[model samples]
Target: MHEGATLGRRFTTLRAEPHDVPGVDRWVALDARRDVEVTVDILTSLAPGAVRQAAVRAAQVRDARFARVLASGRENVGSDRVTYVVTERPHGVRASDLIHERVVPPRVAGAIVGEAARALQVAAGQGIHHGFLRARAITVADGGRVVVSGLDAEGELATQAGLGRGRTEQADAAALAHLYLALVTGMESEQVTVPDLPDALSLGAANLARAAIAGTGPDTLAQVAAAMGPPDPAALRGLRGSLPSLPAVAHEEPQEPHAPIAVSPETLAAAEHQTELSIAAAVAAPGVAAEVAAERIVAPELEPGAAVDRSLYASPEEAAQFSRRTRKAVERERDQPLALDTFEEINEEQNAGDDRSVVQATLEFAQRHLPRNAPLDAAVERAQDRAGRSGPLSTGPLLVGLFATALLIVGLVAFNMLVSPVPMDGLSTREPDYPAYTFSPAPLPSASPSATNTE
Candidate 1:
């Protein structure tokens, strides 16, 4: 096993110098260069974003498409769970009447990274754009816990195990399970598409999360806690519990190497079945997980011809605003799927280069090179079918019944509203086609005959 491979895999490299308070600026390496990098300074900022609850709701679906996309791909499983690192600092005040201190709900300036990840489409063996994450994993050089101080230190304090090995990997199974359940909706058991989850997840963090939330229900904190643990080499082995154990320390090992992404047609098609299902599910329920699943977000109500890639905008705020114009108000259209084939094409240009490729780069290639003129409605329908089968598993039959009832009601209403009294007049038209013609006799010859006397 190599050194720091586990922990380092989740992040790109960061070059840092100590700020007076130890922060980062003028990064030489960053997670992505192709897509706009948003610097979120946590000072009680609020931007438009997806709600965490909706994301959790999507995660709950028991489907296969979701599984294939999440599991088949190399996930950011090594990193800590997605965090909403909130800190309160004084920005300019919105001074309302001081006397009535309104207890306003907390303004969420912090964006949920997991949601951001959905647009990134990080997965196993996908090529990257020339991208790097300028990340610094600081630990005490003297065998003590290193304070992860850079930029927003308070934000650092709020996030994932903060550089300690926590058991987050076990939830990969559960996450993968949800991934698949979101895919194969309406199949029989063989085709039912269940993501294989290890029967016994030894990861301590998951166990703790489960213990914490078991009574209340499946909360995000419990779920995040669940993911804390080891990496499995056989992450793609379809059978349940087939994942082989890798050393926990190996996660941080930079030396240990694995197979690189192969750039070939057959290689691209290797996970086709799995990927197809996952994509179908993603387009259907493109929740916050879209980043991890590597789906481009489709803005709401975009015309079929418009670009729907989530990667286009720098932040969710930009996306939200673009969706709000009278000419433009619509949810983001996840554009990466439209570009998947492009990833298959020029991937060799990006293959096997850690320094050059960012996940966004690979997706950008998809956006740039993949055929954009797809039959948009058809793809959506296909994804919708899969998503419905995978998700809202119970609501379908009810909706069908409701539709039938609605039709009946509509028919009855039309019969009543269309009623009118009969008119007494038989017909309101008269014939005007025939015209009379008169014939004149030869009366002019009689006048001339009078001159000829009594002949």
Candidate 2:
């Protein structure tokens, strides 16, 4: 299939090649429509009912550590039936990859298992078990965040469909322990040796791993989470074992040189005395005429222990001279005025000019690339002008007008309430009928009178 081809009518395949999932025919195809990277597992051979049930169960799961199922459905592709389940793509290397690369620290392993256990707990709460909770199913995201994926609806569906064995909470716990062991020893074997765990890890961490794998320790995931605390940074330093040894180099024939002559005892003793003096001088006053200090501290020949003074220098004058020199140096440093050199001033000016140039360039670039419109420009200008001349927008008159309008409404409502008639006992009484007025004939009159006169 080509990239951008629609999958299930909503997700577009981002790449042509699909990632193969181990022990399953379903290949992971990256989706383009998702905000975060997500993969859709396209299974060519899965029962429709299994797909539907898995989709429902996957949707019901809502845990941060669990890779959420975005969508799942069955679709007809050409002459074949295909089932697809889309899940959020976790953003890190696989736990198994990390395990093979280097030994995972015990504390880090504990923490990862702990996180996975929490996720398992969530799945168990929803009556869903992760049948395939292995190292490859777990991902260590950035910032050491552990994400558990591969909880495809098909696996659960398969189990329910009687094609495979069903997974339980206890089984998930055991798998988590195995995962921890694999990480600690950098091996994927069921037979775990707690003694092989790095010396850097705590005893509690080792025990936790053993308990998890053996089903002897914390039976519940919550208890496991509580037991596996955060890994110690200091302990993590010694997590990895020694590096592999290099190949041995072949030896060549040895060459003989002239024998060295022995040095006189007097010269050796004097050299040793000088070394001791130098060390003492460095310890007493570092960088303060170290060589001269060492020389001055040299022991003078004593005439039968003749009254040794408890002073570093042989005479008081020497001590006074040393103090005077130190004071002079301090005075010189204090008297010097603090000022920037010509080179420093020049550099500062150059830097300021460069900053201005950069700002101008950025502004020009933005103007060239950014879209513009006359109405938007006008609106922005108006907003800027308003902002420049700002006092708070006066709402006093508006508030007063609103208050008056509210009062009028209240008054009208009150008047209507007071004057309106209310029906009593859910019946309306009709008004009594009034007599109607009848018009009397004015007289057949004038015409009849004229007729009578004529007769």
Candidate 3:
């Protein structure tokens, strides 16, 4: 594996070497976002879609004996579309490696194979079969825990010569039997033919393996492991080595302090004098009140240790320093009466007068400033006169209007009578205002000639 390589664009590889799987490349990668370590199995020259689909199915199967699939996808590397599956990193030596060094007793092998078989059974119940189950697919973790890897992405095992691929319960059972044989015999072979076992091997386990190879074994691999019983604790003691020791952490060295900059004697003395001036000015003068000095000086407070005097206004000496125009403007501003003072005087006068509502006083005050327009005044006076007056002049227009309207209607009637061609007598045949059915009498029965003769 390349240094600093990543899988799924999320999990970054921390180790340069991959785990010892037969065909697939497995790296211990760190999922930085989740802050957890995971195993990323990169399958080369395989169908990315098939492996991804299998990984999805494998993820749904959860068991302590099985490594949990976390994620899977295809990532482009150079000219190749690499298919990778991420799973929880099982912390144990692979059964293939452990057996390669030395074969464990049949009982211990049974325990490990049984756990793997049970895990496969669970997966089978959910319709997911481990297509390629080899000795390397199982791991002997701490406390003799057996964890089985390789689920949907088992197609990578097919890349190894002499290993066949089968995606069914039967295939899984047969492969699991093959793994058990390899574990006990310490022989790493992927063949299905049953080999001669040592006399120490249990007859039940031997028979089960033979039947599994012959396709006549129990329906589930778990049942076959059950017949073999649990493993021996003593036999399993030396199978897994001690956990690796943690590396010593190095402490960071403390940094040296920086030296203070050196200042000359004259610069130090000037800085101290400036600080003293600032302190004195702050203590003696309180903002705007400081301007009341006898003689106005430009930035006088900035002078070191300058004394300030207490006064309400500048002295004649300071006033003389200003221009004539400035003095005139100031004098004019001081002489003018304030709006508040004028309002107080007006209020005092009102208090001395007869008691009056505020609204009435306000109206009187507003009237004094009202425009004295003769036309407007005359218009208002006329409106008041008309309001009070009760005579013919006020109603004369309405009366004249009604009389003129009557005269015009009579003139129109006379003109219409002279111009119209239809006669008044012709109106007799016109329909009445009420219903004709109700107004007209019932028609008299017309006398038939025969009835008249009988009468």
Candidate 4:
């Protein structure tokens, strides 16, 4: 079809090129009678009855989120018979274009997919489903509105029929999930392997995507959408204002040639007469231009205020602000003392190498690059071999480190036992001491002494 060609004597094609839908020749056309822009999907290969039925069901789905179907019928144009469905042209950036251009944050990507799901959920309620769903079929419009095009047209034109409602619904949900994944991961929907979700995605969103990929999504499309929650307004704000406007029809009309703008010589002279006179006078006078240039190059006179030392570094206000901040910081430090002088201690130890403990140094170096456990003998041999190869560094230090670790552990155990030891009587086989709670309260009586003696 060529541009300006009329279909059914109503919709006129704005452009000769058709949108890249796999099996359908979809074009952006203007509905002459309605004075509105709409998309016309011309199907010469699909079943006419199926196409009409799909369009009729799609038209029944009245949603702002969807590009509403206007009409569908068989049209005899020229030598061939074709089935066409006219739907409102969606006004926004297609998800396909947006995802390809830049990396969309997960929140924005999820929001786009969530809005599509909500629209499809509504369509599914009326027994109408978008059997063929992909990123290309969805649009992100201004104010975060998602207008889903090719709802049933895509399926009908692509021959996606005979898939039962259950299957179609599941396919749509999975396709939506794939679309979300593509937006988030910047991969195509047809990718066989599911990519890893970005760390920024919330746990709930990750789980929802994983479930859909595993073929255990929610029972209804609505449930799947609800789990994603509402679209994030903040994320959507970034995508709202960049929607592409609908293409306009190019009707060539006779254009009159624009005359060149002209200005009179007298007007030009009047505008710059004084400036011209001054320049000519300056040129006539010898050394006047040079004097003017010298005057321009000369630095301005300085004003006296604060001394160079203080003012060069900072102004009064800035100095005051800094002093106040420093005082506050000192007060805070005084109130809350630091647990350790970490940097100072480390720097001192690093600088004063002679004062450092040999055993401690060996332990630190050994711990810094400790490897997996090996036989003690093998490790000693390797250390010895390395020490021999490198003269000053010896296995003797490493040996001391191993002995120090063992001695430290033993010392700790001995300290603990000395501080809190088990009683000698506990090791005896005597009957275990009765719990204090088990003994009944002493029979309180005035004659307590006699009761005690009896006990």
**Which number leads on TM-score?**
4
Local accuracy of candidate 1 as per-residue lDDT tens digits, 1-455: 11122212322324322221122122222224332221221111111011121222323333321211110011132442121211111111211111022211111000111211221223111321101111121111122111111211322222221332122223222332222221112111123221322233334433432442333222332243234322221322221121122111112337868789766433333334345447666676556446535653333678879875544334545434433542242223433345566655465454423342344444445544643323332233234333333221256899999999999999998897789655659766787877788778666545566677876
Steric clashes per prediction: 77, 0, 0, 0
Candidate 2 backbone overlaps, count: 0
**3 versus 4: better TM-score goes to:** 4
Model 2 residue pairs with clashes:
none
Residue 157, candidate 4: alpha-carbon lDDT: 60
Would you list the clashing residue pairs of candidate 3? none
Clashing pairs in 4: none
lDDT of 4 by residue, 1-455 (tens): 55677876889889644565554677889999989888887765424455656777788777888888887765456765566778888776778776544566777777887778888878887777887777778887766678888777677666533432332777788777777766666555445244656678776678777776676774567765766677665666547453333122233588999998795443333334334445655785567766554433222345787333322233445555655676798899887736566655565555543333454456446644763222332333344334333233357999999999999999999999899967988686778888667765677546668788998
Q: 273 in model 4: Cα distance from truth in Å? A: 98
Predict model 4's lDDT versus the native. 0.66
Candidate 1: 10-residue stretch with minimal lDDT = 104-113
Among all windows of ten consecutive residues in candidate 2, which has the lowest summed lDDT?
239-248
Where does model 2 exceed 4 Å of error? 1-4, 16-32, 45-48, 152-154, 157-165, 212-218, 230-455
C-alpha lDDT values of all predictions: 0.29, 0.61, 0.64, 0.66
